[model samples]
Target: MDLDVAQVRAFVRTAEELHFGRAAGTLAISQQALSKRIARLEALLGTPLLLRGGTGVRLTEAGRRFLGPARRTVAAADAAVAAVSGADRPLHVDTWGHLYAPMRTLARVAGRAGELVSGHGRDLPSVAKALLNGDVDAAFGRVHPPLPAGLAHRLIRLEPVDAVLSADHPLAAEPALRPDRLSGGVLWAPGPLDRLDFLHRFAVRFGVRHTATSVNLGLGHFLAEVAREPDRFSLMPADVPLPRVPGLRSVPLTDPTPLYAWSLLWRSGDEHPGLKGLVTACAEEGGRSRWLEYDPARDWLPEPPASGPEPV
Candidate 1:
């Protein structure tokens, strides 16, 4: 039987992710397209390769047996293309958390990293999938627990977060606000609290009682919404340039500052020529700007910093 390499690739990526939505994203296709590819592959094999249920997709016995050969097939196809097209293709990089201004960090290293094609992922999960699927060479974002296997990350920056409040708010005038001091007010988040790891953990850790979510139209709109209510406030990286929203002030959180961690993520075995230079640039920049400096006694992180040197 003649196997379609694309269909085999679709199955492999879906099996790896176990989530159709993320698998489709990594392939840069719609969910419907991904499903069709998998269905066709199963039909070609004359048996169901995967079982879909409430929990997630699961591999059938046939699928378990086919996975190894399928991976080799995909790798062979990629190698053939690379050999013919040359290896000088621009490295594709992606980022997540636009609201936090991930580009601000990437911009500093882009020029030094050589030719690059940049894109954006909805979040770290999507970006991680893209890395594993070989769609992108590198990514930058907050790397937390429960990440998929076969991925690596390095802590690049530890940006201090600030509380954005309306100028009319009582605490807005304070030179610096302690985390617990804002516990009485509502925490305005750009999206659902659960999806926003940093904000959610900050609320629970610092005793923020009331929380509200809003669509993240853009930084300006989000900040404007936060400024509309005297009792509402939200967290943002201190270095992000605040749009000129009226009656909005950013107050630094003190007595244990909340440091938003930024990390570089890529597939474990990737040897993309540009990857090393990018990591080196991040390390140099981090050292020059003290981006990785953290003191547990004076700062807060949702988890302990990643261990080991920056992956080169």
Candidate 2:
């Protein structure tokens, strides 16, 4: 049988708060509206759920019984909806960042029932807006100040930023590299990697001073450029495997570089079955498993960088 999720949700919130006024505030509606919703909900159930007295309000026998189990039902319904939503998509997203490999890996784990694709697109701000605007299904990237609005997020993975240096560098040959070892090398960085302002804001935290030059180039291009420079190097999503750019190679640098977390994001009101399915497929991947297609012959590991950084 179909259930009024709105009614159920209202009931659970009010019951937990134990006060209609407080619950109304929590639900971001007025007390009168909340009372009416509860009344409608009780009418549908054919029973009285709450009783108001001088001491405020209390659940009735039916409501006491319903309160305990109804919360579970609401949560279950939310889970079911989340499942249906993530698994209901044939389309995909490719925000420029490090979440690509793992995102694709999730699709593989979801099996043939779901089809996933990855492509480069607009900056995080715009892509996040696009997802909220129903342009794309989801985007993966970091936002320092938190997402603006009309968006829902689930963090998929954390990618450490590594000080990448040319293979010929003295530290590049080191097995265990640290930040201090990276001192004095010419640095390459995205103008804004995960909105941390590239390595500028994070350098002090990392205890390493870097000379920023190619901050405007995207991650892919920066890596390629760093690969070309004989003595130049940069920082990138460490987990993502970098492909060989002919004369270049990348190795980890030591320091307290910020580890950027990328999350799966979508518009709050987007309920398209295709998009939802795709989202669920991604959410299920997490770090426990990966769901992407990797090409090895290209000098890159299974799932290195997905998209480039935004142009400064």
Error of 2 at 280 (Å): 3.8
Q: How many pairs collide in each candidate, listed in order?
A: 0, 28
lDDT of 2 by residue, 1-312 (tens): 456777787787787668888878766889898888889988888889999889988889999888746765654565477566654445566565442244433444456325656656556676764553334666666544456544666655555556666667666667656655655676666554435444554555445565655555445666677776656776666666666566565555433334555556665544445555655555556434542322333222212434532210
- The residue ranges of model 2 lying beyond 4 angstroms of the native Cα positions read 1-94, 98-113, 116-119, 192-198, 215-221, 228-231, 253-258, 274-276, 290-312
Q: Which ten residues in a row have the lowest lDDT in candidate 1?
A: 75-84
Clashing pairs in 1: none
User: Which regions of candidate 1 fall more than 4 Å away from where they truly are?
Assistant: 1-8, 16-49, 52-57, 61-84
Q: Rate the local accuracy (lDDT) of all candidates.
A: 0.87, 0.59
Give the Cα RMSD of candidate 1.
Answer: 4.2
Cα TM-score per model: 0.83, 0.52
